[model samples]
Target chain A: MLPDSAPLSAATATSPAEEVLTVEHVSKSFGDNHVLQDFSLTLHRGENLVVLGKSGSGKSVLIKCIIGLLPVDAGRITVLGQEVGALGHDELDQLRTKVGFLFQSNALYDSMTVRENLLFPLRRHWMADRRGQEESMVMQALDDVGLVETIDKMPAELSGGQRKRIALARTLIIPPEIILYDEPTTGLDPITAREISQLIREVQQKYTTSSIIISHDMNCVRLTADRVALLVEGRCYAEGTFQELQQLDDPIVREFFV
Target chain B: MNSTILAETGAITNFAWRFFRHGFRPRYEVQELLYQCYVVGYQSLPLVGITGFIMGIVLTLQSRPTMAQFGAESWIPTMVGLTIVREMGPIITALIFAGKIGSSIGAELGSMRVTEQIDAMEVAGTNPFKYLVVTRVLATTLMLPILTLLADAIALYAAYIGINLKGVTTLALFTNNIISTLTFGDVVPAVIKTFFFGFAVGIIGCYKGYNANKGTEGVGRAANSAVVVSSLVIFLLDLLAVQITSALGLN
Candidate 1:
């Protein structure tokens, strides 16, 4: 495992040698059921790390704890060098502005049109731009996801695949330094899933941002992950690159990708 | 016979208690409240307005014949005004509000959660409770009173039209009679009760929608629960308010 505070150099794409996130010895439990036990991982400035696990293996729970969605019963999660739990409300909102999350369901606000969906974040953060730079920024994000033509359409009008793509566009509209993707391609057809995988790769290549992708799909783990972690028995059972994991003889590792 | 009603009452009480625990906590959502207001208040105004007008006219017309037997037809305006301000206005307006706002909130939030939008907000570093529940509750609290007042006004106007349908009372006399009969006690108590009605409806909607589980079935349950609970709360609060006002010699 990478050291929690290990400094970044070549992988530091956003700034001059910065470690994006450091999570150390995190443990979470729901009463008697332990979801995450002593889980730890460090995300570099610009790399994409995919987490793979079987169903009910605490993959989503680990990321949720890191993002402060599910309060960690134990351990530490630090993002951009600030402790996640110790931050107050304003601080948490500030930190959140820096991070973008793509939910498993796309989570596009159904009340809004695609244009409005893209504007939700912009409207919330409009205080930052005195000059109003969002006209070009929104168009650019939508263009990146190949959704420039569907700006006026509501989410209910869009197909499942289109919704995921629009969600991806919204994620980039924030220009976040770190992205947490929760099952980015779970319910899509193989072609759409592959397209989503390609979009993930494109996002990684285009943005000088780091990401933690939570997916059970091995093809995604194989295609986009620079490193992979298997969450089993409420802990990181194994951590390595896809190739290294594939080569392992252990039943847990073999069973995950097989 | 009592068992079924007792069971239903118990279920509602338990649900209200859960909502209290979740809603009272800091970082609870208020976004759904705004959406609810938009749906329950703004979108529903036209329907309630029309209904209130017709209700007033019909009530005035129906009452005139009965009062005419005692040559008390001149009391029509006072009677209509009292009915609108005291009872018909509040109950009908609330039920209409329940049908529109309560159901929409329940269905929308239930669907959002089932679709995982609530979870997405949490991951995106936004508090779902603040974003979803708080706005809707606050909006309802603010809007419901305004809606009820509007409904009461329209209903009174309709009652005037109803009075004119059968016999003639000059608008001035009609106006004077309505004004003289309307006490601050009647108006204030009725208005005060509306705020509770809105709060109950908003809170019940948020509670049902937020805690919804089970998928498509959950959405139905949420909507069903919201309407049922909000309607009950409206009547219960009305009963309590009437008692308090009577005790204080305001009735």
Candidate 2:
């Protein structure tokens, strides 16, 4: 197990070269219930960091805080060099365009069709040079998820796996510098979950985008994680390469593997 | 109980403040506002129309015997017309609007909140408040007044039909009698109050829905409370409007 004070660096042969996100001694609480206490972790450029934790262990809270949906009670979060809490609404919005977040629920808009849903973020960010190319961009995003045929369908019409893929496609459409996956494989079947995990890996390679994936799904962690950080009681207890973490003798870490 | 009410009032007021802060800024959601207008105004027509017609007919028929007993049957059109335009049209339409649109906005936003769709919108670089709340509130505020006017017209027409159902009063005479009784004071105050009614319904619905919690159950609560609160607010606003109009010697 790595020291808690040190940054969670990958022990793999091809090491992470740059830092894209840093969570330093972050603590968040809802009233007296401290969900995270002095939690610290860093996401490297072009590497997948899976935060492994049990249910309701502040995994989702961490993701929300990073995205500025929830404010941290203490400490700082730096995303692509800008302090998360310090950014204004418009500035945060500008930063958000560079970072993609995939919610566990997929969070596809029920009122809009897939095409409109894909166009929502694209148009909202309003990349002036790409105005007329919206159709092609949407098609490309759909093709990435292999759901181009379901482009016109509402979110309610898609299957669970399809919805997850479409949600991923929506994130990928903008080609963000970093992608945060909050339990990407939480509710899917084993095969679908594996497919999603593989897709996560493929996205990392294709875009060379850094990612922080929150998951208790071991298979997903095994498939997608270049490095793994074990969150225990609102702290980064230990972190290492997935294989290195597996070889560790710590019982708290072993509990996750078993 | 008082503290809870105070807390809720404070929160709603804060929500309103946020609405004003973001509502008038550039990058206006004109398309969403128009769509919401169509939904809030056009789609609500059939129900509001039927209610107005029935109200007009019922008021006319119910008052006929009383008017006959007082030898004032000739004054029925004037009486019904003044009542519909000055009170019943606005209050009844606002109530119906609160029941339908208020509940809808609450449920929709609550569901979106629970499912993280709202956060997704934020992450997509779109202010969900601007896109959802402001558009909806603006739609209700602008559309409610128009809907009230339409309801008043429909009810007056129905009252005319109710008059013709028994007596053979010509359409021209009936209209003239009703129009002659309606002053600017009667029309303007009632029309002005409908805007407040609409704003109340829209803001309350958006507030409940936008702040909803506890998953699906929270959504249910949001929708339920939105209708209840907005309905209550409609009556309160109507009372306040009456007081204001009376104070202005428009009564």
Candidate 3:
């Protein structure tokens, strides 16, 4: 067992190239709750799929099923042609290394500084050889988020928006083929939100990796998403471009967007 | 049966089985385990140690005169050792752990769940349970016994000191008295129960925190449940452990 002090560095994550993620009709429930019901969504390589929903709409649960965080009562999730829910622990981890996540609250380890956080995915022996390149990539990712100045700071030392950006940097530094963002713009001000939206688009353009963003922010949905899906009542109620979705005049879409 | 209670019980049972399975798996999440130990064990030493010392000393001091009234002061060492190692030692340490490690784990996972970070792990083709929950639970299970051992030692030492204050006795004589009264029977059961204490603390903390919902309120629920449930489980498990240990003739 590697000592607990070992860092999770970004160097260990990169995969061959672009990979598409697919989630078929997946349904999940905790007893009577029916948390996710017949949820279906498709993510293409390098495409950004934005999910917008109300507070209890199961938008997040849909993502969880796709990545096997929560098991589906039925259906399948395939990432890069491998079935996600069917895989064993090691296989699942191997798949995780290829995906990056930007937590809504910027779940940076409070114990570590920005530099240590940036090197987290790469510091372990598994990523030891790729450490230098990962470090450089992290620097570039931090630069992309306008957080290059705060490398020495702890998560508490940064502003909320800055923390979100650091989370973005953490997600991007690993240079994974898929990146998922949850509430990427929820707590930010208009200007900062715009900056984040721009950054998301920039990442899509740069990495050409598939991305799925879970958010209630309409502006974010409109700006960075190539296609939008409204996850409600345990299912993908609707899926389309923002324009297509906006034109539908569905009550759920109106409630979410307006 | 009411589903909430029934399901909770079933969930507890199911989680217990998985914990044993994944806890010993290769790639032991060594770092996460250490992080938990550091968070759950090392940092908690001072508090648990102090608690154990006072528990032993106070128990001895209070009971000494009482026992002396019955001409039974000699039971001080065995009594202190039994109280510290078997019950107070594990229970107090777990409560401290429930406060420190439990709340932290709850708050951490609760915030992650609310923020959708845990979801992101899933979309990235990661098993959030394995990465987040299993590693953490395993870490707690492994470290709690070690912490209990340390607390047990500290408490016994404090009991000796307490005994010295009120009466006259040589180190050898005091030590001999303790040694003669104490047996593997006392130590083994006391130590064995601690593992349960630790496991209960970790598992209850994880279950409450990981299953939290309702955003900000979820975080509160997680922290609150971590402490309340783990604390309750300590007593429940202590009862079960004692029953089993006595039944097995380890008493």
Q: State which candidate has the highest lDDT.
A: 2
Residue A176, candidate 3: alpha-carbon lDDT: 83
- Residue ranges of candidate 3 with Cα displaced over 4 Å: A1-79, A82-93, A99-111, A121-132, A180-183, A211-258, B1-3, B72-100, B121-139
RMSD of each: 5.9, 2.0, 9.1
What TM-score goes with each of the models?
0.83, 0.96, 0.76
Q: After superposition, how far is residue A155 of candidate 3 from its true place, in Å?
A: 2.5
Docking class of 3: acceptable
Every candidate's lDDT: 0.81, 0.93, 0.76
Q: Model 1: per-residue lDDT, tens digit, B177-217?
A: 99999999889989888888887887788878987889999
Model 2 regions more than 4 Å off: A1-16
Rank ordering of all candidates by TM-score, starting from the highest = 2, 1, 3
Of candidates 2 and 1, the better by lDDT: 2
User: Using TM-score as the measure, which candidate wins?
Assistant: 2
| Evaluation by TM-score, superior candidate among 1 and 2 | 2
lDDT of 3 by residue, A144-222 (tens): 8887889999888998889888887877766788887878888789999988999899988988778999988888888
Score candidate 2 by TM-score against the native.
Answer: 0.96
RMSD versus native structure for model 1? 5.9
Clashes of each: 19, 0, 12
